[model samples]
Target chain A: MLENKDLLGIKNLSPFEILSIIHTAEKMKLRINNKKLRENTLENYNMVTLFYENSTRTKMSFTMAGKYTGARVTDLGVATSSVNKGESLVDTGVTLDQMGFDIMVIRHSMTGTANLLARNVNASVINAGDGINEHPTQALLDLFTIYEKKKNFKDLKVAIIGDIAHSRVARSNIFGLKKLGAEVVVCGPATLIDKNIECLGAKVTTDLKEALKDADVVMGLRIQLERQKGGLFPDLREYSQIFGVNKDLMKYAKEDAILLHPGPVNRGVELSTDIIDGEQSLINEQVKNGVAVRMAIIDLLIERRKKDEVTNTKWSASESFIQDRWEKRYTG
Target chain B: MAAAKGGFTTICCMPNTNPVVDNEILVEYIKMKAEREAVVNVLPIGSITKGQKGEELSNIGLMAQAGICAISEDGKSVENAGLLKKAMKYASMFNLPVFSHCEDMSLVGGGVMNAGEMAQRIGMKGISADSEEVIVARDIILARSTGVKLHICHISTEGSVQLIREAKLRGEKVTAEVCPHHFSLTDEAVEGYDANTKMNPPLRAKKDVESIKKALKDNIIEIIATDHAPHHIDEKNCEYDKAAFGIVGLETALALGITHLVEEDIISPLELIEKMSTNPAKLLGIDKGSLEVGKVADITIVDPNEEYLIDANSFVSKSKNTPFNGHKVKGKVKYTIVAGKIVVDNGELMD
Candidate 1:
């Protein structure tokens, strides 16, 4: 059972919790394929998607996951919503909570937006993605996909390449992979990499070849071309040539090394066109697993909330019974 | 009442309030209000630019005559350099020190915390040290050229300290103040995503904290001021990037200094007093910060051995947006006398 009611980040999750989430996701993946086997795990549960930032894949993934589990999912369209009329994130969360929302999956442009909402509301908060912070579900799905290919996580060399500084995907993967006993190496240009990322228990390197050496899993992070305006790099062509994953770079890893990317992939930038469509690529599998992983996370959090409610009710009932006996005894 | 409860006999108010204090009328208005209603002395620092918009200079000469002790563009740097130079020249003519809030707006680029490992780890944009150091360098140069008494506010990074130290060595009329939060905390404090830890120039790295302590001890940084900005709970209880920058410092300032600097052997108690009280008074050209004969009895009596936790809820200030809540520290204020009248007694404000 998951100890936390909210899935904020992989950094806070234990090894047991990580394995449990992955195992539950495995069962969910089977249920996703077989319609007859689908259980109404989250029946009548009210889940809302509160995305402050624009997204198609992640938003749709969570929506579908909720629907499959028989939970009613509502997308709070931020652009058309009262957020423009100056309603704060807390206000929106509290209003939803008052309306009896069971879960809130939030993605915002600011770092720690989910944590902020989780602190204020009673609803179980799932961090879809926050600015520069962890995308816990994305990492979970990636882990699920990797586990499908590799039997166990132990001693698996995972080399993650490209914009590690701004990639929440890379940050979440590093945290999750390390807990599963995987040797994680983060490779990027000096400007695109953060200072002292080794503090997060990853081997930080600028050399792509060095990072990929004998790696079991090779992950590519999208190069946000908008960062070019900030002068992080000169241009995309230079970035593609140096840090971009290609057939040449793949030779550095093991023959059986599998590829992973949190998509909307920038072809020939973060990875070459060939590598993205190659047999070793698990990018398509990642999206499919995204729904299953989210379902598992939502179900687990709802289960935890139910357990808490039962415990609270039992305690309150016992206290009332004891008070009745004392009142009767004193009156008699 | 908040200033008095913080063991402050007098506090200089920043010009960044609603309706920026730019003119003689506003300066005089503040003086009148403080005299009528305030328990402690309130010295209003006038803005460097009219409306604090950084477009043109304010009524510096007129406001100085109207009893404004200093001129500042406190919340942000004056972006236009030539205009700032003119303001500095005008301020210098009136003998009012320019309290510069040094930050290059372009360099900040929507950063919420210090551009460091902690910010990167959490996926938040970082305000690089150069954002502050560049402006510190620019303002120091401007001060030297205009010969204005330049007082850098809330000096955080080590590079800024080094620049200020070198400026003082060159005998430029430059002095800097370090806030208690700067030396007491680091960017690591932002890990929990608490909006309270959010502040301007943000909490820097451990090396910067060490450098700030060293700067205080060596007299490279001459003063300690609370960039004591108070915001509504609604303003702070939001997303980290959306939250307002700054923590309430006036109440926690002395205790933090006593615990972090005095108890830790970074500086002696007398040196802490010199930094906190004497040096600030000297920079503002005030006649207080002493117990000498015939001096005004503006005294703050503190029991330096008393240990307690900082409870923001117990604060006399209406806003409890302080990051130092439950922070254990020594030193409790026993009495605060403004012109020999008891204002704060036993750490509580009196009528």
Candidate 2:
């Protein structure tokens, strides 16, 4: 069982916890297709999706995951809410917590937003994404997809190419893969990569060929075009020719090597159209696994919450009973 | 006043407040108010720019005559070089020191903490060391050209230390101050995303902390002033990016210095006192640092051997925003006497 009340990042989870989450996700994936088995797993649970940044895949996945488990899910659209009128993140979180939200799935543009919210409220926070910080659920799904195919993480060479600095997916993946005993290498443009990323235990390289050489799993991060305005790269053409994952780059990897991209792929920017839709591409599978992983996370957290409540009730009952005996003895 | 409870007999108030204290009327008002109600001496430092808008100069000449100790464009640097040079020249003529808050706003970008491995790991924008160094270099050059008494406030980066050291070596009328946070904490403290750990010139790397200690030891950086900014709990208890900059430093400043500096043997207790008291008074040209015969009795009595954990809740300041909560520290303030009056008696404030 997960020991922490919140799933803020993969960095805080141990190797044992990583495998436990993945194993639980495997069971969830099997039950997800069978409506009868999936229904009522999380009955009476209320989940809220609070996204500060625009998202389609992550938001939809969490919503679907909650619905499949028979939990009431509400999408708190940031644009239409009081947040638009300048309600602070804490105020918004506390309001939702007061409304009896059991879990809050949050994505924000600032790093550590989920951690901040988790500290402020009683609800379990599941980080969808936070600025350049980890997107725990996204990485969990990617791990689920990889584990399904490879059946093991030991000795796997995972090459994550493109925008390693701004991509929270890459940060979460590097942290998760390293704990699973995989050799992770992050490749991107010099300006697109951060100087201190190697401290996370990932080998950083500018050479795409060096990163892709005999890789078991190859992941491509979406390069935000706005980064060009900041002069992180010159243009898409240069980025595509040098760093874009295409058929030519795939030749450097093993014949059966799989590919992954945290979707809405900027086709032709981070990955070529052929590679994104290729036989080895698990991009679509990643989306399916996202729902399963989220279900597993929500279910496990609710289970823990239930156990904690029972333990608290028992402890309080025994304390009151002892106090009653002391009071009677003194009075008599 | 909370300053009295913090063991400070005198504190130079920064001008970056509501309405921006720039004119003679405000300076006289502060002086009159302190005289009537304050238990501690309050010296008001007027702003370099009129509104701290950095567009034009304030009433430097008139404010100085009205008993202003210095002029500062603290909380930010005067972005305009020519305007700052002109301001520095006027300050020099008035015999008033320019306490510069060195920071290049353009270089800060959107950074909230020191730009390094820790910031990168957490995925927050970083404030590069050059953001501070470039301004430190610029101010030093301006001070040398204008011949004004330049006291750099809260020197954080190693590069800034090197710049100040070089300036002092050349005998430029340049001096600097380092806050307790700069010497004691590093960027690693920001890893937890606590807003209390967040402050301007954000806690730098370990090497910068080492350089700051060495600077104090060698008298390169001669003063220790608390950039004591207090804010409401609502302003601090939020997301790190949206939270306000600065922590309550007045209460914790002395204990942190004694524990981090004196106890570590980086500098002697006497040297710490000189940095905290003697040097700051000398920089401001005040007659109050030492307890000589016939001198005013502005003194802070400290039990250097007493050790205790810092509790932010126990702080007398309105805002309890401090990163050093529960931090085991050596030394405690036993008494604080200002001008022969017992203000802080046995660590408790007297009515």
lDDT for each residue of candidate 1 in A1-332, tens digit (9 for 90 to 100): 78866788998999999889899998888889998988886788999999899899999999999988989999899999999999999889889989999999999888888877776677889999999889999999999989999988899999999888888899999899988988999999998887668878899899989999999999999888789988889999999998899998899999999999999999999999999999899999999999999989988988888997987633222323322322332333
Candidate 2, chain A: TM-score against the reference: 0.93
Report the C-alpha lDDT of model 2 over B21-101, residue by residue, as the tens digit: 999999998999889999999999999999999888899999999989999988999999999999999999989999989
lDDT at residue B28 of model 2 (Cα atoms):
92
The worst-scoring run of ten residues by lDDT in candidate 1 chain B lies at B318-327
For the second chain, the TM-scores of the candidates in order are: 0.99, 0.99
User: Each candidate's chain A: what TM-score?
Assistant: 0.93, 0.93
Highest-TM-score candidate: 2
Give per-residue lDDT, candidate 2, residue B200: 95
DockQ of all predictions against the true structure, Cα-based: 0.42, 0.42
- The per-model lDDT (C-alpha) reads 0.89, 0.89
Model 1 achieves a DockQ score of 0.42
Q: List runs of model 1 lying over 4 Å from the truth.
A: A313-332
